[model samples]
Target: MSFRVGNAFSDPRVTMRQPQPVVLIRGTLNPAHVSAFYATAFPELASWLNLNRIPVSGPPVTLSHIASSTMMEVAAAYPVTVKVPTTQRITMGTLPGGPVASLIVQGSHEYLADGYDHLRAWLGENGYGPGPVSWASYIRLPDEHGDQRACVTELSWPIA
Candidate 1:
């Protein structure tokens, strides 16, 4: 079934963020197959991090190139406590940190795009435009062994 977003909520404050080290997995995937894509991608990232002895300092993040809807080059990233080396699909990079607008979403994964729509609308309303990229940080994910009724995500766009 096609997903539809309902209502969206945003934090009142938009802040400047500092650049931080992250390990990312980049690939192109269809929007409709994101769940399956992540299922295979995230674990490989997790294993790579574990094998490299890197500690996860923050939530999992997925960044997208905002230009296309059919197929997108997306990056799945995990913030690390310390800088690490680039290897294979996982690479060392910085998550874009600067002027950003964010929306906190709490719901099923299928509806997460609704949060992005809200954020985009809010950015345009406030005279902010997409700065080449946008990201969704999974504040809370479905359990490894089970699913949850709600998931918490922060949808953010770097803005001018």
Candidate 2:
């Protein structure tokens, strides 16, 4: 399918879009803390975790849910063709119409963090403020495959 790059929301959040099924969990998480998060949060649930890393930009999530403090909301995502949950049989890549901002970059996660910092500062300047932390995920960009520099991910911040 041809994913068109949108300049703006042409018709609000109702535009025809491809949304994927995902799972989500909340609470403080990072690469070091993810193992504990998984163990404590959803032990009995099925899993489809891709390349593992602590998130410095987007919100910590899985294939189906966005676990926030008070609400558990579903999101939009593209398909992940990896075998994860046999029953679910799908993964997520990105969530279009992210409601705030998105930045796609090809670099290390640290570089991505730099970009995120810049975006955060820019948002402050533009009065966007802080929104829900969301992410457009991808398969292993940087992982045990020795391609630590090619991790490409889209960082999205749904601002308030």
Candidate 3:
């Protein structure tokens, strides 16, 4: 319910009016309690949205999934590399661009929500009240280190 008196575009750090695409990655966290961690995130994120003005909702633990969005790249889309050419003639790269909000969190999944809290707070205080943009998860493709405990992911939401 809090709307800022002016536009948030005054800052270069905040990008407004752009297009983006969706991406997903399998995630594994330390202590293996990502479920419980995300569960605690929603309620706080909800309040942060209102306190700002973006009017975002859900991301409820019910979905059982989450992602971060980055600028769309059709050629780079779909991490599942297709070595064989498709005979079925289909659109290959139709990526889009737009405004987006993003956040980075380090450590365990339990702390993901905290970083989100910080993001929402910064948005509310800055300007960019909740806007329309699919929440695209673009976490780094797992590293070869074979250490699931050190996995890291970036959470992004596209906007315009």
Candidates in order have lDDT scores of 0.77, 0.43, 0.36
TM per candidate: 0.86, 0.45, 0.38
Q: What is the per-residue lDDT of model 3 for residues 80-131, given as tens digits with 9 covering 90 to 100? A: 1223222232112212355656554443455455545555566677776544
lDDT of 1 at 27: 81
- Candidate 1 segments whose C-alpha is farther than 4 A from its true place: 1-8, 67-69
Provide the clash count, candidate 1: 0
Q: Provide the RMSD of all predictions against the true structure, rounded to 1 decimal.
A: 4.3, 10.4, 15.7
- C-alpha-based local distance difference test score of model 3: 0.36
Measured by TM-score, the strongest candidate is 1
Residue 52's C-alpha lDDT in candidate 1? Answer: 78
